[model samples]
Target chain A: MKIALLGGTGNLGEGLALRWGKLGYEIIVGSRKLEKAEKLASDYLKKVGDASIIGMRNEDAAETCDVAVFTIPWEFAFDTAEMLKRQLAGKVVISPLVPMKKVGDNFVYVRPEEGSAAEKLASVLEESSVVAAYHSIPARRFANLGEEFEWDVPICGDSGAKEVVVDLTEKISGLRALDAGGLSNAHLVESLTPLILNVMKRNKTGELGISFR
Target chain B: MKIALLGGTGNLGEGLALRWGKLGYEIIVGSRKLEKAEKLASDYLKKVGDASIIGMRNEDAAETCDVAVFTIPWEFAFDTAEMLKRQLAGKVVISPLVPMKKVGDNFVYVRPEEGSAAEKLASVLEESSVVAAYHSIPARRFANLGEEFEWDVPICGDSGAKEVVVDLTEKISGLRALDAGGLSNAHLVESLTPLILNVMKRNKTGELGISFR
Candidate 1:
C-alpha cells in the first residue's frame, strides 16, 4: 500500500515516513515546495536503504496515495485539507494534529469549533475519511529507529478508515493502536497532548507517551 | 495530619482509607449516616491492624480534619460541597471527581460550568483550597493493597494545598504526583478519565490506570 505524509518536512512526518518505508510500504513525502520535499525524501531514503520512497508536491502526493497522513501543524492543516479535498476524496487520511497553544508557563488544548482537530479536518475534507491517531507520541523519539519503547495510540474515526489506520499503526515498531471510538471522541485524544506536555514540563520528566496499565 | 474521606463508603474512599490508614495518618471516614461510616472505618481498621482510623458525620469530619477529600460521586459532590462550606474552610480539599457521562457506547467528559469539576468545586467553596488528583486511578485495584502498579497522578490547584496533596500522594507505594499547573488546568486532567474509559471499553483492556512513560 502507498502512503503519503502530506507536508512531511516536520519531525512527525519524517518519523512516519522512515518507519513505514523500512517495512516496504511506499512512502510519498509531500511538501508545499517540490525542492524541499525532494531534499527530505533523499535524506529519508539514505536512512532506509532499499525502500520505495519518493517526493511530490502536496496535490500530486494526495492524488497518488491510497492513504495519507496530515502531518502538518494544526494551524495550516485546514487550508491544506481544503486544497486537496478532491484528490484525497474516499481515501483514508490520518490526523495526528493537536490544537494547542502556550498560556503563560503552561500549554493548553485549544478546542476547535468542530470539537477537535480531526473533526474539523473531516468537516473541511467532507469526502475524505479522516481518522485521528498519534497525538500522544513524542516525535523525536519515534524518528530514532533504535529507541525501543511501548506506547498506546488511540484512534478515533467514523468509518472503516479507523481499522485501516489501526492496522497501519501496528506495523510500526513499539506502538499499539486502540480503537478509542468515533470521530466525536477525537477531542479526548487531542487534549492529551497538552496534558502530557504540562506533566512533562512540571515534573521535569523529559518526554512522556501514555501507556494503559 | 488528619484526613477526612467525605462520603467515605465508596470504592474510592475505601482505597484512600486503606492506603492512608496503613501509612499511620489519622483516617476519618465520613458518610451521611454515622452507622455506615463507623462500619466501614472498623472494617478498614481491622485490615490495617494498628492505625488511627475513625468514623464521623460529614460535618464533623469536615470540621475535624486538616485535609478533606471529596470522595463522593461527582453528581452528589456539589451539594455536599455547598453544605460543608464553612466546615471545610481554611483546609485543603482534594477532588478526584471526574465529570463524565455515557453517550451511546462511549464515555464523554462533561465540561463543568466553571470549566472542570475542580474549578467548579473551587467556585463553590471559596475559602477551601481545592486540588484535583486521582481521577485516573483504578480504585478497585488501589484498594486491593496487594496490587502492585506504577501510576502518575497529575495534580492541579492554585494554593499550597497542592504541595500537601502531592506529599500525601507520594506516601502511597505506587503513585508519583505531578504538578499539572493551576486549578484552571484541571479540566485537562479530569477529561483523561472518560478518555481512558472509552479506550478500556472499546479495546477490551479491562480497568486502566494511566502511566506516563
Candidate 2:
C-alpha cells in the first residue's frame, strides 16, 4: 500500500521512511515545501539503496496515498492536518504526534483540550481513520539502520486503521506493536513520549526506547 | 532508616514491605486500624523472615519513621496526608499514588487540578519532602516472592529526598531507579501507571512493568 509521511523531513519521519522504505513499501515523503520533500526522499532512497520512494507537496501526497503518517512537529501539525483534510478523507492516518514542552529542566506533556494530540488530529481529519502509535520510539537510533534494538510501540484508535498501523509497525524488525486501547485512551500513549523524554534527559541515558517486561 | 508504609494494606505496600524488610531497613506497616496493620506486618515478616518489620496506627507510624511511603489509594490519600501532616513534618515521603479510573475498557489518568497525585500529596503535606516513584510497578507480581522480573522506576522530586527514594528503589532486586526530573515533572511519571495498566489489560498480557532499554 502507498504510505505518505506528512511533514516527513524530521528525525521521526526519517526513521519511519527508512525502515518502511527498505521493506519495499511505496513511501511518499510529504513536506510544506516540495524541494525539501524531494531532497529528503532522495536522501532516504540512497540510504535504503533500492526502494519505491518519492516526494511531493503535502496536498498531492495526501491525495495519492492510501495511508498517511503525521510525522510533523506537534505545534504545526493541526493546521497542516486541517489543510490536508480533504485529501486524507476516507484514508488511514497514523499519528505519532506528541504535544510536549520543556519546562525548567524537564519536558512536560501539554495535553490538548481535545484530550491528546492523536484525538486532536482525529478531530481535524474527521473523515480519516486516525490511529495513535510510535510515540516513544527513540528516533535517532531507530533511523540508524545499523542499530539493532527491541522496543514496544503501544497503539490506540477506534477503527480498523489501528490494525493496519499495527501491521505496518511490526513489519519493521525488532519493534513490537501493542494495542493499548481505543481513541479516548490515546492520551495515555501520547503522554509516554514526554515521560520517556524527561527520563532520558534527566538520566543522560541517550535515546532510550521502552519495553513492557 | 525507619521506613513507614502509610495505608499499608495493599499489594503495593506488601511488595515494598517485603523488599525493604529483606534489605534490613526498619519497616513500619501503617493502617487506619492497628489490627489490620499488625496482621499484614506479621504476614510480611513471615514472608521476609528475621527482618525488622512492624505495624502501627498511621499516626504513630508517621511520627516514628524517618521516611514514609504513601501506598494509599489516591482518592482517600489526600485526607490521610492532611491528617498525618504534623507527624510527617520534616521527613521524606514517597508518593506511589496514581489518580486514575477505568473508562470503559481502558484506564485513564485522572489529572488532579494540582497537576498529579504526587503534586496533590505535596500540596497537602506542605512540610514533608515528597518524592514520586514506583507508579508502574506490577504490584501483584512484585508481591509474589516467586515471581522474578526486571523493571525501571522513574522518580521525581525537588530535594535530597529524591536521592533517598532512588537509593531505596534501586535496592529492590531486579529494579532500576531513574531520575525523571523534579516534583513539577511528576505528572509525566504518574501518567505511566494508567498507560501500563491500559496496555496490559487491552493486550491481555497479564501484568507488565516498564523497562527503558
lDDT of 1 by residue, A88-124 (tens): 9999999999999998989999999999999999999
Reference contacts reproduced by model 2: 0.96
What does candidate 2's lDDT look like per residue over B83-110, in tens digits?
A: 9999999999999989888777768788
Question: What is each candidate's fraction of native interface contacts (fnat)?
Answer: 0.93, 0.96
TM-score of each: 0.99, 0.98
Full-model lDDT for every candidate: 0.93, 0.92
Model 1 chain A: weakest 10-residue lDDT segment is: A139-148
Q: Scored by Cα lDDT, where does model 1 land?
A: 0.93
- In the range A113-209, model 2's lDDT, one tens digit per residue, is 9999999999999999999999989999998999999999999999988999989999999999998889888888888888888888878889999
Q: Poorest 10 consecutive residues of model 2 chain B by lDDT?
A: B102-111
What docking grade does candidate 2 earn? Answer: high
